[model samples]
Target: MTVHLVGAGPGDPSLLTVAAAELIRQARVLVYDRPSMDAIAALAPADAETHVVGLRRGHRALSQPEVNDLLVELGRRGDVVRLKSGDPFVASRGGEEAVALQNAGIAVNVIPGVSAALAAPAAAGIPLMLRQNSVTATFVDGNDDDEHAEPPDWHALARLGGTLVILTGRGRIRRIAAKLIEGGRAPDTPIAAISAASRASQQVLRGTLSTLPAPLPPPVTFVVGEAAALELTCTSPKAS
Candidate 1:
């Protein structure tokens, strides 16, 4: 049996790739992370066995090791779908799970999807790169908890000078902003926070390194750079 690691995209059911949708539809067992993924998980066959391994109001959250063990056990039974939000590898534990499954001698397949890092900025009309303003884009995990991995170097990021897309950084945005400023980024450097991107509830808040925007709900993607100030989607006539 093979376990399919599928990207459910960024909170929108319609954003799921054709391959991802097809796999879910045929899944004999569906495993997903957050409760927010219910919409996409609903695509699986009604009889499919479903498991939620992440945080839920009444359910115990599964640790990374527990999740990997669960996937391995499920993979031996039948067709399994491990649904992850956004792209499976982008700031996600999907990679670790994949490794565990492979080491257990189970076949694994990965399906790519649109990451929120890219979608959020686009939905907010903030270009991650502009011809004369920004030529690079850097993506970092704001809530990284890997004990073996070194923490993000915020100071170095500020000095690099590019579009910075931080995933899961909503809670620590203020401190992050301070670090950026300390690293030489101007206090006026534009920043934008896009929450629930690509969904009906999507919200975009704008500010700068010195004046961070008010907190939005979870699942926020933060864009920091000159490009964050440009809302190309705005139709208002520009001052000539």
Candidate 2:
């Protein structure tokens, strides 16, 4: 009777909220994002109808319109669950889908989950904030604009002096970091590229803007801040 917007929480099934998990297990029509991974799909009840919209691309995922249409049509059925990767409300464009369904006279509910902006960095042992360091946190989506995208207004963020987490920012990482540097952030500012976050295969690469050209894995998350530098001290020493 309701169209629920559920957050799959980064990539870990265990991170899903109890309510979100319940909604998925009880769902009969599960419209999901392929990026959500097998761990998330396993949550679906045995009898549910699962639609793997982005299966072809692996977890890179579906176009917004396709995901929107699926959610809206499923809503018309009166009991559908629109599953999202990471917290549905984060950079997820969940609001857009919710608005579309509501405009079509469909009731909607949101079940929150851990967002990559937070989980990714935490997995690398980088606290987004600390008492002696950053006191505030700002989350930005690094969706590049035309021409490889203009970077975020790094000057403004530099002025604010807080923790910065950039989501969907893999492609624009170098640009974003450069902008922040030009905007007055330290060139040695700490950065962690957390990819496939929260999963067993998750990888974290720590570097400064000067050393960022090194190789990295795909589907990554970028966390930028002076606080991020602590990742070195926070991480457990590796075996010889």
Candidate 3:
């Protein structure tokens, strides 16, 4: 038996890859994270045994060890599908799960999904990179425990001359903005926060590095750069 690790994309069911959809239909045991269930969880077989192992910022429905054990146990019985939001390897902790399953001698397959880093900004009409002002795009996980142990070189990032995409940073935007500005980013550099990205509930908030709008809910994507200033209108920012 094999355990398939699939990406559920950035909360839009339509963004689910064909392979991911098929895997869900074939799953005998469907294990999912928080965001995947919001849209594509129902795609699983009617008889599929579904489990939620959602890991939130301060809450965890199922601990990592428990989830890994569950996957191994289920993998021995039949086809198992582990659905995670965004690319399975992109901050979803799929790598650790994959290693756990491998060590347990279970075959595993990983299916890549559209990352929110790109989709969120695009859905909100923010170009990640522009020929005029941006030549590179950098993605950093603002909430990573490992990252927190060692402070990032904001000054070096400011000197990179590109766009910055920060995922899961809604709670720390104020501090992050200050760091970027201290690193040399202009206080007026455009910044945008997109919440519930790619879903019907999507909301975009516009501001600058030093002048962020009022706080929004979690699961937010923050874009900072000259590119964040563009208003292509794909999705307009609501009034702050």
Candidate 4:
């Protein structure tokens, strides 16, 4: 038996890769995370066995080790699909699972999907790169542990020109923004806090380094840069 580790994209079901959709259709046992669960689960066959490994802020339904064990257990029975939000390799622990599965002699297939680092900004009408505004794009994880473990070098990041996309930064934006400002980033640098990106409930909050809204909802994507201020004409209302 084989297991497929798939990225479910940034919430918009239509954004799922063609291969991801096909795998869901053929899956006999599906393991999924919280984001975009309803939409992705619907794509699976009616008889498919589903296991929800609820992953949320402040609450983890299943530990990574547990999920990996479950995948190994399920793979031996039938085709298992491990559905994760965003690109399976980005932030999602699909790589760890793949390693575990491989060690157990189970075949693994990885299907890449759109990551929110780029999708969230585009969906919110914020271009990440532009000829004049920005020349680079950088992604950083703002999870709570990030400040203590493998913290980003805000001073160096400030010197690098481009866009900064922070994922899982809802609670750390103020502190992180302050650090960036202290690192020489302008206090008035444009920033956008995008919540529920690409979903019907999506919301984009625009402000400067010192003016971003407090307590932004979880699962937010923060875009900070000159490019964050440019709203392209082709952006749709649904992006808001």
CA RMSD of all predictions: 3.7, 3.7, 3.5, 2.7
lDDT of 1 by residue, 1-240 (tens): 999999888888887899999999998899999888898899888988999998899898999999999999999887789998899999887899999999999999999989988888987888898889999999999985568789899999999998999998877888888988999899999999888887777788999989888899988999999999888885311211
lDDT of 2 by residue, 1-240 (tens): 678889888887877899988988888988776644667877787878888777555354567777888787777876998887888888778888988888888899999888888888877778887988888999988875635446567678766767888888777777777788878888887777888877777777778876784546655788777777765334322211
* Per-residue alpha-carbon lDDT of candidate 4 for residues 9-56, written as tens digits (9 for 90 to 100): 988888899999999998889889774478878889998888888865
Which segments of candidate 2 are over 4 A away from where they belong? Answer: 55-61, 146-151, 213-215, 232-240
Could you tell me which 10 consecutive residues in candidate 1 have the lowest summed lDDT?
Answer: 231-240
Off by over 4 Å in 3: 55-60, 147-151, 234-240
TM-score of each: 0.95, 0.87, 0.89, 0.90
TM-score (C-alpha, index-matched) for candidate 3:
0.89
Residue 41 of model 2 has an lDDT of 75
Q: What C-alpha lDDT values do all the predictions have?
A: 0.89, 0.78, 0.83, 0.84
Q: Candidate 3: global Cα-lDDT?
A: 0.83
- What would the C-alpha RMSD of candidate 1 be, to one decimal place? 3.7
Given candidate 1, what's the lDDT at residue 2? 94
Per-candidate clashes, comma-separated: 0, 2, 0, 0
Q: Write the number of the candidate with greater TM-score, choosing between 1 and 4.
A: 1
Clashing pairs in 3: none
Tens-place lDDT per residue, model 3, 196-217, is: 8877778788999989977777
